[model samples]
Every structure is written in C-alpha cells, then in structure tokens.
Target: MRLPRSLVGWFYVSPLMLVLIPFFVLPMVVIITASVLEGDGFGGIMPFFTTQNYIDVFGSGLTFNLYFSTIKFTILTWVFSLIIGFWVAYFLVFHVKNQLLAIGLFLVCTVPFWTSNIIRMISWIPLLGKEGLVNMILQGLGIIDKPLEFLLFSDFAVVVAYVHQLTIFMIVPIFNSMARIDKRVVEAALDAGASRFDIMRYIIVPLSKSGMALGSIFVVSIVMGDFFVVRVMSGGGSASVVAALYEDISVLQYPPAAANAVVLVLVVMLMIGLILRTVDIRREIAR
Candidate 1:
C-alpha cells in the first residue's frame, strides 16, 4: 500500500530524530541545565542555579586567551591539513596508474585510527623532545650543534601534532570527492590539448571543492576542541581551553566546567553552521 506523504516523511526522519533525541538533544539539555545549576559528572548532584559560572568564563581574560589560542590552532590545523591533504588526494585520484596502489596509499593515512589517540600522542614526545630523535638526527647529520628547546612544547609542535592526527580526516573527504569524478572528463581534457596543470585546474580541482569543504569542516571541528593533543604537546595544558575544563572538573569546580562545556558546544555548532551554509552536505556526500 502507498503510504501517505506525512507517513513517508515520518518514516524517513524518525530514525534520525530517535538518534538525535538521545545522543544530541538530551545531552545538550542536561549539560546546559547542569551549567545553570551545580552538579558533578556523577551522582548526588546539587540542584542550585546560578549564572556566575557563565559570567566567570567571560570575565576571565586568561580564559579568553586560551579560547583564542585554541581557535588559532583550529584554523592553522584545518588550513594546512586541507592544503596537504588535498594535494595528496589529488595526486592519488588523477596521478596513480594502478588503482590498487592508489587505494593502498589512501589506506596508509588511516593507520592512525587503529591505535589509541593517547598512545599515539605520547609517541610524539620522544621524536620532538630536546634529546629526542629529531635533534639527534640533525646533530648526527651536522645540521646544527644546539638542540632546539622549543621543538616539543611549542605552538609549532602542537600544530604538527594536530595535523598528524587530522590529515586523514581532511584526506578521506577529499579522496571521496576525487573518487566520484568521472574519469572520462580527465581523458577528454587531455585529448583537447590541455596541459597537466590545465587538467587539474579546469577539471579535477573544481570537482573536488566539495571534498575540500567537507575536509575543512571535519578537520577544523576536531582540532578546535581537542584536549589531549594540546595538553600533552603544548606542555601541561597551559593555554588549552579544553584542558581548562579538565582542570576545573578535576578541582571539583563543576559549574565552570559545565559552562565551558556549554561554550564549547556553541562554538562547534557555529562551525557546523558555517560549513552547512557553504556546502550542501546532502548533495556533496550523496554519491
């Protein structure tokens, strides 16, 4: 029997709504409520309400700086990851001759996901530390006499750490975009006397804009709110917004933690809203 329009619409949307209600809607409501009130992450919570926590987050200049630093990391990580990732994906999509070889190269990017994020991040310490592999290798090669003290615990290292983790997030979306391009278009461009750059600029590049956008969205959001990477790499979470919340919670400052969580949610939503406005995710990922 043919379902009514309302019924069909309900059938199409109920699953998503069901998932959202629990995972998305409920969590936000509880969190925001917790922000306005007082409660730890466990049982026996306080139910008192106050706006001081929200005010405190805004009033603190240090907190604002931390927020800016996080945003800076997010922006740099996204931009660089996209640039490098797009190039790699483009090379694979249009350059690799053997399809299997191309697929294998793409799979190499995802190997990080198989391991724990904590383990992977800690692994970086040995390579970038003052007495570590990079400095030793450089010294061995007569590159420099002094070990770079700023190598491990600086913004540079933090950004590098983020990019290492985030490049795959950028690459996968771009690769998906490249995969959908009609191969005949590339051949047609070549047949029409197009140069190598012309084929990329005129055909392959234009088609992958959606992928770039998708990758930017994924990379930006993940890097912006990441705690562990910034905490470990930036040295003791000194200026990390996420780590600020971790500190608050560990110290039993539940209200401020909730407030930070609220702010983080809003920031993420703002990012997502910006992305959705730029790219119709439905059409981009439909294939």
Candidate 2:
C-alpha cells in the first residue's frame, strides 16, 4: 500500500530525525550518564555508577520540605491563575465586541513578557521596597507609621511573581478553549431558562476541561520549577524546589544535585500522570 510519494516524505522528514537523534537524544544520554556517575567539579566524569542519587532523592529530609513547599505553591498558583485567566478569557469571548479592544486587553496581559524576568523582578523592588511607592503611600495615608515588613520575602511575594509571569500562559490556553466552545450551546442553555451561572457550570466548564488541564499543568510545572520568583520576590531569603536544587549545586554536591533534579522531575511527572489518569487526557486531546 506504500506509494513512491512516501519516499519523498521520508526524505524531507529525515533531516529532522537526524537532528533529533544527535542533539536531543545524545544530550539526554549524557545527562543520564552524568546523573549516574560522579562528576568532578571541572567536568571530568568518574567511572562509577550508583543509585545513591536516586536514594538521596527520596531520603533527604529537606528534599521533602522543598517538595512540599513547591507543591503548596504550585497548587495555589494554579487555582489563582485559572480563576483569573478564565475571567479574562470569558470577557474576551463574551463581553468584548470590539476586536481591537480585545486585542489591546490581551496585549495588556502580555506586556510583562516583553520585559526580562530579572528586570521584571527587579521592578517589584521599587513597589515593595522600604521607601517604595506602597510604603510611601501607606505612610502618607497614616495607615502605618513604618514600612510594612510583610511585603517581600514572603509567600505573598512568591505568589505575586508566579501569577504575574504565568498568567498569560494560562490565559492563552483558556482563551483558546473558550473561543472554541459552541455559541449555540450557550444560547440554548439561556433559551431554556438556564442562568448565566448554569451556562458556565454545566456547559462552559465541561467543554473547557482540556484547556484547564493544559493551563493547570503549565502553571504547576512552571511554578514548581521556579526559583527566581522566590528569589527576587522573596529577597533570596526563601527557596522553592529549584532554589533548593541550586543550593545543592552551589556547594559542589553533584550527587545530591543530580538526585535533587531527578526527584523534581519525578514529582512533576507524577503529578502529570495523576492528572492524565483522572482526566483521561487522551480523550480530551482527541477532541
């Protein structure tokens, strides 16, 4: 059943396959080798393989602490991002009739991405600093005589950074999902005396599950893998999972660093697997 035309298809696709095998696959093999073997600080690989990395991943007490902290942030960020993103997306789909205005709104959501994350983080300093705008305003308003010490280096700062950076990622997916939903369904729901809440709860949410799943996964993964959010926003006094991994690497603990990285990967994968299992992601994807 094969055609001569298929030969041309293979010939064109062969280059990408060649590139993938060498760059992507080869680097993965090197990472696995390095993760298994001990590495000298100067890049020499020792000739031994052990499960100590894997063991340390599970056994280290602080690893669990980092893991738990990251999970806490991931869950919180996901919920908040979804709620905010969904609202933004809904407004774009249902409320905004002017396409130019909608585009402007989306651009508003996207402005943060144009700035470097480090720069964006540094920008927060002025607002949250001791004599920054918020502090100055509060002091002037007689709300407090002293600057608030609760602004930066806190979970609030972490969440603020996470939501700021990742909201667009969540919004785009949810917005795409919302745009694809059938208008007739909403109209039908309304014509049948269904309230706005009913349209959202019964029809909209069910159809948007795929987008929610995608957005949730992205938000959780980004938030979990992040350190800079906690660093700049939290004033380097706090550590998320990636920050914890960086701490291990900073001290030249290769085995522990590798172990920590592997553990982070596993935890992320486990969460993704759990989501896929619960959602039957294959079905949603097929749609």
Candidate 3:
C-alpha cells in the first residue's frame, strides 16, 4: 500500500504547519488583534476595536528616526558581516590544507557564543573604552595624546557588537554553500586556462548566490528584530524600531507596542520575500 506522492508531500509539510501555527501564526494573530484594540491605560486591553494605535505610530516623527537608525545599522552590519564571513569561509575551504586544522580554526571562531551575549558585549568595554587597551596602545605608540572617545558606547561599538555576534550566521550558510562546490569543476576551469580570479568570479560566486541569499536573510532578520544590543552598545544614544516598541511596553502601552510590532513584522516579511524571489533557498539548502 504505497502512498500517493501528494499525500507524502502533505505529510512532510504537516509538521512544519504545526510548528508555524503554534509559534509564528498564533503570535502574529494575537499581535494583530492587540494592535486593533484600545488600551485601558491600566496595563490592560479593552474589548473595543480602534485604529488609533496605528495612527499614533504613523504620525510620529520619532518613528521615522527610529527606523532610520535601525536601517543604518542593518545595512552596515550586513555589509561587514558578508565581507568578512565570505572571505573567512573561502580561506577555510580553499587555502587551509589540513582538514582538521581548518575545522579547529572554524570552531575557534564560535567560542564567543559559549558565553552569554550580554557578557560578551560588556567584555568589549575593557578593550575599546576610553582608558582601555586600544587607547593605551595608541598612546604608547605616540599616535595621540587623548583617548578615542568614540570607540565605546557609540555607533562604532554598536556595529562592532552586531558584526561580532551575527557574522557566524553568515559564515555558516556561505561555508555550506561553498563546501558543496565540486573541486573538479575548478580543476577543469584551470585545465582550460582559466585564471584563479576568473574561476572565482565566474564560477564560485555565481554558484554561491543561494548561500549568500540565505545568509543575508538571517543577518537582516536578527539585526532588524534586535533591541537589547543596540540599546546597551549605544549607551541609549541610539534607538531601533523594536527599542521603541520596548519603550511602549515598559509604559504599559500595549496597543501601541502591538502596532509597532505588526508594522515591523510586515516590513521584514517584505524584505524576505524580495530575497526569496532571487533564489530558491529551500532547494539550495536541500542540495
């Protein structure tokens, strides 16, 4: 009694639907419902439905500033992570001759994740702060008489934290994609007189697009949804959409917080959709 192909396909997809329903769909539905309801000003929601929450979010100039700050961080983090991750993966896959040593080095990069992220972020202060190692070293080198105030508790620190934490996301996917490439193809290209640069540009890069897209999706989603890192790293000097949402929640403004959350989810979905249109990540990952 063999099952039909469609039935097998449905069975495979059923588990995914189960997870999505409980975790993703239900939460989004609750948020949407909350976004439309009126807040009772006492940390509770009223039964009445209203659009005022969204109206308030849309009307505020601070909303624009929040999103702008978030987008700026998102772009910067994505660019730096992609560049560093891609090259590091490339080096591991191509340059390192010993497989054991290559994997050991790769695992070394992941040592940061063993500790709490808050601990890691705080640890940077001793190395990047005004009187930290960086300032001491520079002063010893006669580079400057004053410490670099912008190194910590600023935009630079925020970006450094983001890249440090999230570059692993990019590296993993890109490494997977690059690892599956057939070295025979490179040998063939070389046998045909193709230079290393030509092979990389024409063959390696084109084939790695799917991995790049997947990595981009992960980087964008994490950075866009984060509030804590931006808040702590920036010393409250910067703000994000989620940070604004957090502020509303702290004040017991449930409706406004829900509205902000819904908008951010929609925008993130649109960005992911755009990335998916360029590559079939599901098939690529399966391969």
Candidate 4:
C-alpha cells in the first residue's frame, strides 16, 4: 500500500525526529517546565508552579550585566572571525590554482581540531601569560619595559580564545559557499572592466552572504552559549550569561538556572530566525 505524500515525507524524517525529540526537544521541554516550577532549597524541585524564577531572572541587574558581557564577546568574536575567515576562504578559493593544493591547505586548518578543545585553549596560556613567550620576546626587543599583564587573564584573552576556536567554523561554511561560485562569472566581470575590488564588492560579497550568514549563526550561538572560555580565560573576572547560569547550577538553584536557560534559548532562536529570514540557508545549499 502506498502512503500519502505527507506520510512519505514524515517517514523520511522519522529518524531525525526520533533523535531530536529524545535529545533536543525533551531536554528543552524539561528545562521549560522546570523554569516555571519552584525549587526546594536543597536541590530538589517542588511541584508547585511559580513565576518567581523568571521574575528573579528579569528583575536582577546581574542578568543584564551577564548578557551585556556575553553579547560583547559575541560581537567581537564574530567580527574578527568573519574578517579572518572570509579573507582566508577567499584566498583559498580565488587565488589557489591547484585543487589538490587548496584541499591540502584546507586540511591544515583542521589540525587544531585533532586535539581536545581544553588543551588547545590552555596552550595559549604559555604564549600569552605575563612571564611567557610573548612578553619575553617583546622584552628582548625592548617593546615594553615590563610584562604585559593584560594578555592572559582579561577580556582580550577571552575574545582571543573564542576567535581562535571559532574561526574554523566560519571558514568552513564560507569556503564551501565560495567554492561553489562560478570562476567564469568572475572572469567575465574582469573582462567587462571590473577591477578586483569591484568583483569582490558586487559579485563575491553578495554571493557569499549565505555562507557569511551561516558562519555568523555558528559564531554567535557558540560564543553566547559558552561559559568555560569566559570563566577560564578571563580568570573569573568576566562572566557570561551561561557562566552565571553555571554558578546558579553549582549552587543548586535549578529553577532560576532553568529560567535563564529558557531566556537564552529564546534569544538565540530569535537571532537564528532573523538570519534564516534574511537568507534561506537550505535553499542556498540546495542550489
């Protein structure tokens, strides 16, 4: 017996739905439910429904501060990652003549991923620490009189760690998008008296928007959701929304933490929705 068209589609998506429902959707539902419930003072959840968790989340100045810090990191990381990732992808796509060479170069970018993220993050410390390689070299060259204390445990370090880890995410999607561009179209534009800058401004940038949007979404979401980088790199000086949530969780404040998580999820979804509305990623990928 033949199934209906909708049923056929549902069958095709059944595996994905099975995975998402159990892993993603169920966790989110639980979190949302917990957000409205009261927490017993000793790490237990009470059955009583209350809005106090959300009220505490919104009414607290700490929430706004945490969000401000998180957003600041997100914006800085996104801008730097985009600028670096776009140019790297552009060079690989437009400048590299040999396909094998381009592929090899791309593989080199993934070398860092072979290691643990924590290890990679910690590795920056020896180089950026006040009494470390960077400071030693600068001191040898007389670039500064004393060690630069701001390098390791500051906002700068946090952003540096985020951009280092996340730039690869930007590069992958942007490279994929740029690789799909027609070389002949670029040549045609050049033949029509369009300069390099003109081609990049009109053809390259416009065509790469889908990839940029995708990369932006990745960078934004990761930076916002992350707490470890902020907490460790910033030396407990800077705190993100997730970091604050981590604190709440550590203190057995599950209900408040759940409320914060729900709010964060909504904000991230809103940002992603805006990106999807601006550029249909699925449609672009299909093309």
Candidate 5:
C-alpha cells in the first residue's frame, strides 16, 4: 500500500508548486504569449501573431545604448560593493574576538534597512546635492570655491545609491561563508610560516567563493532589473533597459515591452547560470 518515493516527494512539494504555478509560472506564460502578439498603434493588441516585436527590440540602437549604460552601472556597483563587503565581513570574522560584539556590529548594519528602500535612496539627496551638507562642508573647510555639480543627479549619485542599497546583500552571504571557516586552519597556516596575504589568497578567498557567487547573483539581478533609482538619480540623463520597458508600457506598447522583458529575463538567467557554474552553491551550503 506504500506510495512510490518520487510520488511522495511530489506530494510534499505540491503546495509550493501550486503557489509558484499561479503566481510565477502563469504570469511568465502570459508575458511570453503577449510578446509574440501584434500590437495596435493605440493601446490595443491585435489577434495576430508576429515576431516584429522581437525584431524591433533587437534592431533599435536605443536598446544597445540602454544596455550599455545599465551594464556600466552594474559593473561599478558590483566592484565597489564587493570590495567593501568583503573587507567588512573579513574584519568581523577574523579580528573581532568577542562574538557578541561582532553580532552587535552586524545588527547595526541592518538598521538602515528597517526603512523603505525609497527612503534610503532619497536620504542621500540632502547630503550630496549642490547646496547640500557636503558642498557646504567643503566650502567651510576652504577646500573648494564652488558647489560640486556632479555629486547629485549624476552617474556618481546613481552608483552611490546602488552601492549603499546593495552592499548588504553582499555582506550577509560572505559573512555566513567566512564564519564557517575553522580558526585552527588559519592558526596552522600561520604556524607554517604563511604570510597574512597567503592565508587570505589560499584559504579565505577560495572557501568564500560560494558566498561571493551568491552575493554577485543578488547584486547583478537587482541592478539589472531596477529602473527607479537610475531614472531619479540620473535626473533623466540616463536610462536602463527596464526604464525603456517602463516607458513602453506607459505608452501601451505591450508587445514590445513584453519582448524586452523576455529578453531581460533571459539575460539575467544567463548571468546567474554563469555564477552557478563557478560555484556549486548547493554542495557548499550542505557543508
């Protein structure tokens, strides 16, 4: 009377499948369907199938420009966040002798996240604006004669906002991986005449690859999909692929927008797949 093992596994996962099917899979199916349909000049869709939407998306020069801008910001944010997050996690794991204090310090990092992301992003404006605190402080210090125009509503601001928001995603995974390292391994390496840099290069970085890969996935996905921060922070001077998609949807260009969405989803999945190929996350987590 016993059921098959595979059937039992499926039974256990049925609830999750039900949720994903209705919420995730169904929506994706609808989008893919819409992407292949024809759109009227107005805010309507024709009952016809065509590949023109994909063609338009791929043929447009604006598409390349938008992707280029987005990728530039993505790389800048990823590099800076990785550097800062790695050092912060390393400091907490290796230097902090008191576990309670390290935990307290870690909790401090999460305090800014208690507020909404919009609020956190907007908070940078007052400090970075032309007449804001930074400029005022510079003037008072006699360091500059005029207000810095590029601090806010520029590419600098976009990268700063992105790094501030996304660094925590990097920290959590890296911290978890570094925390699991045995202190004895480090001590033995030191006893064997290994330099600090050697220990870091050989032991720490290799073991932390899983964490870095996980964090990179988070940073890359979020940065690529975001539009609001780029639009607002760049003062309409820059746009990302998602921003163009938003504009298309606003103008009732559903088919083209859906096509862009499908392309973006594919690109993101490819990036994540590359990261996964670099590290076996499931096995690392199992350890």
Candidate 6:
C-alpha cells in the first residue's frame, strides 16, 4: 500500500514539527503572551494585559541608543566577515595547489571554535588589554607613550570580538557554495577573454548569494540575541537590545523584557524576510 503524497510529505515534516512545536512555537507564544502582561514588581508575572510594556520600550531614549549600538556592531562585523571569508574561501577553493593543505588550513581557522566562547573572549582580553601583549609590544617598540585605553573595553574591542567569532559563520557557508561551482564554467569564462574581476562579479557573487544570505542570517541573529558578549567585552560601556532585556529580567521586570524580546523577534524576522526575497534558498540548496 502507498501513502498519499501529501501524507508522505507530512511524514517527512512531522519530526521537524515535533521539535518546533515544543521548543520554538511554544516559547514564542509564551513570550508574546508575556509581552502584553503586567509584571508584579517581583520575579513573578501578573495576569493583567496591557500595552504599556511596548509603550515603555518605544518611549525610552535608551532603546534608541541600544539599537544604534547593536546595528553599528552588526554592520561592521558583517562587512569584515564577508570580505575576509570570501577571500579565504576563494583562495582555498581556487588558488590552493594542494587540496589536503587547503583543508588543513581551513581546519586551523576553525580551531578557535573548539574552545568555549567565553574562554575565547577571555583570551582576547590578555591580547587586547592595557597591560596586554599588544600594548606591551607597542610600548616596547616606542610606538605609543601609554597603553591605548580604547583597545580593550570599548567599541573597538567589541567589534573585534564579534568579527573574530562570526567570521567562521560567513566562511563555512561561502566555502560550501564556492566549492559547489563548476570549475569548467570558470575556465570557459577565462577562455572567452573575461577578466578575473568580471568572473567574480558576474559568476561567483551571484552564485554565492544563497550562502551569503544564510551566513548573514546566522551573524545577525547571533549578534542581535547576544547579551553577554557586549556586556563582557564592552565592560558596561555599550549595550544592545538583548543586554537591555537582561537588565530588565535582573530587576524582575518580566513584561518589559518580554516586550523587548517580541520587538527584536519582529525586527529580525523583517530583516530575514528582506534577505529571503533576494534568493530562493530552497531552490539554491536543491541545485
């Protein structure tokens, strides 16, 4: 006996739904419900529904600053990651003479991920801090009169840490996409008197849009949802939306935190929607 096609489709999808319903759907529903509810000025929530939480979110001046800072870091991280990742992937896929060596180098790049993220970030402090290796080197070389205060616990350090952590996200997807390209197509273009720049512009970039979009989603979502990185790296000097939510939760302001979370989800969804419009990810993956 054969199942109906729609039924067969559902069979394949059921396992995903099992995970999504309990973890994704239920949590989102709870958050949405909590966002409109009142907080009891303690660790518990009240049953009363109100829009004041959202009102507070929009009305506060700090919200604007938090968003601005987060967005600034996100853009910087994205641009740097894309540039470095694309070049690295291009070189590994196209220029590297020995495939084994290229794979080894790629693995070397990913060695940092083997350690905990907190450990990796903490390690950077010793390299970037006032009394850190970088400062000592510069001082020894007489390159500076004193340690640069802005190198470690400032916006610069935050951006550096973000780029360091997120570049791998950009690289993996792009490498996969580029590796899938038919080398014959590139050779054909080359034979047609096409410049390397033209091939990259018209062929590589267009083909890799899907990978870039996927990588962008990962970077944006992680950065937007992160509180600890900004808090720890910036040393209380900068903030993000999630960091603000963390502060609210610490103060027993559940409704406000929930409201902030809801708005952030909406914003992220909007950004992802815009990105999806540029590429048919399913079709690309199938190809």
Q: What is the number of backbone collisions in each predicted candidate, taken in the order shown?
A: 0, 0, 0, 0, 0, 0
Give residue 266's error in model 2 in angstroms: 1.4
Residue-wise C-alpha lDDT for candidate 1, range 1-287, written one tens digit per residue: 88899999999999999999999889888878878886554533588888877888889998789889989998889888988998899889878979999999889878887888778777888999999999999999999999988889888889888888788887888999898999998888888899989987888777888888888888877877788888778886446777888888787777678788999888888888887887788887885
- Residue 71 CA displacement from its true place in model 1, Å: 0.6
Better of 1 and 4 by lDDT: 4
Comparison by lDDT, 2 against 4, better one:
4
What local distance difference test score does each model get?
A: 0.84, 0.79, 0.91, 0.93, 0.94, 0.89
Return the candidate ranking by TM-score, descending: 5, 4, 6, 3, 1, 2
- TM-score of candidate 4 relative to the true fold: 0.97
- Candidate 4 lDDT trough over 10 residues, lowest sum: 110-119
Residues 166-224, candidate 4, lDDT per residue (tens digit)? 99989999999999999999999999999999999999999999999999999999998
Clashing pairs in 6: none
Give the CA lDDT, 0 to 100, for residue 48 in model 1.
Answer: 86
Tell me model 1's lDDT, rounded to 2 decimals.
0.84
TM-score-better candidate, 3 vs 5:
5
- TM-score of each prediction: 0.88, 0.87, 0.94, 0.97, 0.97, 0.96
Model 4 regions lying over 4 Å from their true place: none
Candidate 5 per-residue lDDT over residues 130-241, each given as its tens digit? 9899999999999999999999999999999999999998899999999999999999999999999999999999989899999999999999999999999999989999
lDDT of 4: 0.93
Candidate 6 least-lDDT 10 residues: 113-122
Error of 6 at 241 (Å): 0.6
Question: Candidate 1, which segments miss by more than 4 Å at Cα?
Answer: 5-19, 38-48, 190-198
Residue pairs with backbone overlap in model 5: none
